[model samples]
Target: MQQFIVTPEVRFLHVVTEPSLRLAVLEHISAGEQHSDNHAPFFVLETPTWDGEGEWSGRAEELRADYEELRAVLAQDVRGVSLPAIWKAPSGARELTRFCLELSEMLRRLSVSPFDGAVLVLAPVEVREPERWVSELKTLLALEELRKARLMVVEVDGSHSEALAVALAQEALRVDARPDEGQLREDMATMLAGMAAAPAGVTGAQVVGAAGPRGVSPPAKKTQARLSGEQRESLARELKMAPALFDPSFQQALRLKVFAAAHAMREGKSTEAIKGQREARDLCLDAGLNREAVILELVLGGYVLQAKQAPLALEVFCDARKRAEAHELAELAVQAQLSAASTLLMLQRFESAALAYAEAGKLGLVASQPLLAIEGYRMCGQVLARAGNVAEATAAWRKALEVTRSATADERTASSAPEVARQLAALCRKHGLKAQAESLEAQAVALEEPPLRQTQGA
Candidate 1:
């Protein structure tokens, strides 16, 4: 068997099967797809007993005829081929063209599908013309329909299957590099299953533009990573495997431990807190604990803000704010906004902070956190006033006072209104307008209607 990497978007798997051709199919196909996404050509001309469960049995010559029949079906340039079922086929030029054309269409679709996908093709190992497969595939894919796509090709031989197995391990690295947690996990699972059946050794695995650097396995553990027997067993249980099957757990635990080590980096422990937070977030996603993740993100956002990294801090808090809005955590969203605004303030981006604070105030009011609402309102007013928009500032402060008053009943003390009024009064006085300050003070007292009096009779 031989492996070839043609383009980033395309992969070709070539193998030689004499008496039986099932090895190539079993080497690649798994439950990840209803069928393999490899749109490339697979040929098993001479094979027997390829289908164990089905009645699809044929001699080598019969299988070759079947392969040609499939080639005829997909020989069209537009409509694509489904992953071909293993069968016998004799070779022909026209049949190969038809097969390549259809297979080409299938490859084109995989590139743009919503889910990341792959293609697998298996054929009888020996062929009259191996170049025919490659040329036909390239021509079919070069059509306007698939001009910009990527492809990868792998060929296998009995002696090289072992090397192929090691090369297949690179799939883990590809998945691990993905930033999206859900996608990463899905890729990891699929790759693992693929690796489970891939041949153990091959001459070389050519991964086109992808498959990353050749021979790079998942990152090696920096130090001796130890796990208690019980912990190992627990992890195996989570993965739904027996204790004896611990390789996957080792990788998962390493990833988690790397994140955990980040937490106590300063103390020289193995883990990092940021990594832990990220893993926790990923865990939340896996468990469908969205609310928990959102809340945790809010806390993490605050921590970033406190660390005084203004830009990075804003990104975190803004994400939290968006999540809060989605979950209807209006109060929490307001808090996130306030935190973001403060970070902006520290950066001397006063106008931006003022706008953020205004948004926080609005959300706080709607969330019924009147005191916080008022405080935000006051801050925005002050910001506007300092920016020299006296009228807008005054309006903002008045709106803040109204919100505070409306939060209370006549019998309830005017919470925060007095302090706000005094602040407004002083601002008004500073503008050399005693009458406006007096009016504000009067409104504060008058809010209680001065207790209905019997003096009307007098």
Candidate 2:
């Protein structure tokens, strides 16, 4: 005999770039049923139109026909189904209030319960007065009868979907229905070229001249090498000559701007570094270079931190982290998280700083950057210790030491494992972990030993 299992909470998600929002809805429904042990009732409520501009009569008729089709389709596969409701989204505040009252009554009558399983709601895109509509919907969903119902809303991106999703639901999931990678790359390249060409201050020839021979060709692939002093001077000169060429819309421009910013930072010209970074960040956003924008924002945040504006720096770094996560740039996201944690430490928000550092360490491990993870754990320990959390701080540093010791010999050398061990030993000794301190000191000494010289037998 199968026992019925009821899901306790409602779920909300946004299908980004999905015009129909059908796949996401259906997938959730199928998953819900598949996971349950017994048969459960399911309901679906769809909205008439995203924008409340069309004729009410015509839109209602269309919605009715669509609902019938959907109900018939669900009837074939799904059991214990109830008639779906169509929400006539209102335009004005007064109408919206009245509509909410009516909807609340309808939901109460539905008697939705945990055993009733999932209730999928297809929301309209291009909603007018989204704030009011979302507020009303939230009230309706909060009714006791609908409390256990798995309420899911499918919404399109760029229609204030995030704002609506956050207001109406506890969790929001993003489904990226972007075009194929090749096509996306082509589109981005085209857009960037157009933006680069449209700016009036710099001609292509001038840009090419300022960028030197490298600008005439497609931008060079990114390398790990640091620029020489001469190269930095050349980049700074070119950037000064054609300031517009520093826009991130052009790869050459982005490279030049990065070099120029680095040079300014090295030269202690914080204002110039911030200005160039801000301009590059705006250009990256415009060009859909989200990852690049996140990196530039981090750079800008570092400058803000240097200026001793910890609050503003934290805000900027948090924004960068959000952007990086949204764009699925894991490495950059970890970097931003670490920067934000550092700013929190500066502001003496010790608990939050520790949590942020811990989160960054976990994310760094996930992103396969063990060195970053080590640094994060180290910072977490430092912050915790400063907050007088001695035991936890010792634990964090010990974890850092453990991670450092686990690395390969070459990786340990590359990542400065000796320095990490020494730091841990100092912390352990300070906290009265004499045995742990001795162990860490031994590890540090071993790490510091020079590699044996290879000799050919004579």
Candidate 3:
């Protein structure tokens, strides 16, 4: 059980448990069911105060800060799960909506089990109406990710309103509980069993799930499966459902625009998506989310590229590279350069692409991202070689070789080292660098050849 789980996102539950024993129950859930010896749970427990004169609704950014901080902790633990070799932490600061969307994306991408994770939030229902308050929390607070990846249990002292429970039927479980640790534990065990049996049915007062039996379960993929288009819209729609009250401010408006743009993209409405993203980017700048604003340039560039506006895409990516550099966002800077390089290639500007990739490689090295550095330099050499720039190609490949040497102990090293050496060796031989070519050939062989197997059967 990883700390992160995916099922229904948020569930409101009130069940019997001793005050003394609630902490223990939380710890149990946080640890997750004992799936394996190496399993780690990524649980976040938040207890927010409600003292300020402003409505919790009004403190959107502050609440976002707390949620994102908890998410950042989860992000670190998420790395322990299986992921691509070159994955990194989610990029820098974002507005509340983008932050929540990113957190949801990261959790969904990284989680291995369904609803095996929990977020235990202990706080008073803040708004005048309990239903409205929870709604705001889900949307405004960006706890919306609770639907697909994990169970969010917001425990309150008083009974929740009937209207609220009814409105969230199937999504929440509100139990009439008293202090009985033993009974609570038994119930939880039963609930967890129900969840494992039918994770798709997450929240109910009776059990986690109670469904008719099915055929033999298929083997789960090592990676999270891609959500279908409908599923993606369902996820996006959750964020787009933020309360109308959230629309007054620039930040919230931008949030809606971004969400709309995203859904449009997923629905294959490119024109609308581009228009919405463009508007959202300007709103980000107006709202003072500078890093996010620059990030949107990257997004707009991608959208433009997809729409077959290669020249405009090149311009946008180039602008993004400059913006990222000015903001000192090294990773985004590398991404911008790489994006521009690819766009340049699409436009048959091979020389410019080579220059861009080389620049990205230099930036990647500066950012301590050896994988990106290796990729950029490798591509630079390839593009240069194809264009018949033998000397420049040799220099780029040699630099890539140096980067691989330093990254030898990295997980990506084995796959990368041999390829870089072999390519460099081929180019070296072509250029008549005989001794260098021979040494590179030996290096490539040493890296690629496997140890001999000892066999008894002849």
CA RMSD of all predictions: 31.7, 26.0, 26.8
Across 225-342, the per-residue lDDT of candidate 1 in tens digits comes to 5446798689877986555334444334333433333333323332244555556665554544456667667656654554555798789889888988887888778888888888
Which stretch of 10 consecutive residues in model 2 shows the poorest summed lDDT? 449-458
Residue 278 C-alpha lDDT in model 1: 57
**In candidate 3, how many Å is residue 45 off?**
43
TM-score of each: 0.37, 0.43, 0.42
Instruction: Note the Cα lDDT for every prediction shown.
Output: 0.50, 0.58, 0.57
lDDT of 3 by residue, 1-458 (tens): 23222333335443334354455655555444333432223333232323322233222222333334433444466344233222232443333344355445444543553323324343333223556545544563335454433333434444444345556666555544355546645554454454445423122331233453433333445684545546655765687532322222333355456766765675578899899999988876665556787898899999989989999999899888887888688888888888999999899989888998999889988987777788889889889988988789878887877776556453343445555676786566566786886587567545543322111110
Q: Total clashing residue pairs per candidate? A: 60, 0, 12
Error (Å) of candidate 2 at residue 335 is 1.1
Q: Report the lDDT of model 1 for residue 170.
A: 33
CA error at residue 287 for candidate 1, angstroms: 2.9
Best candidate, lDDT-wise? Answer: 2
Whichever of 1 and 2 has more TM-score, that candidate is 2
TM-score of 1: 0.37
Say which candidate scores most in TM-score: 2
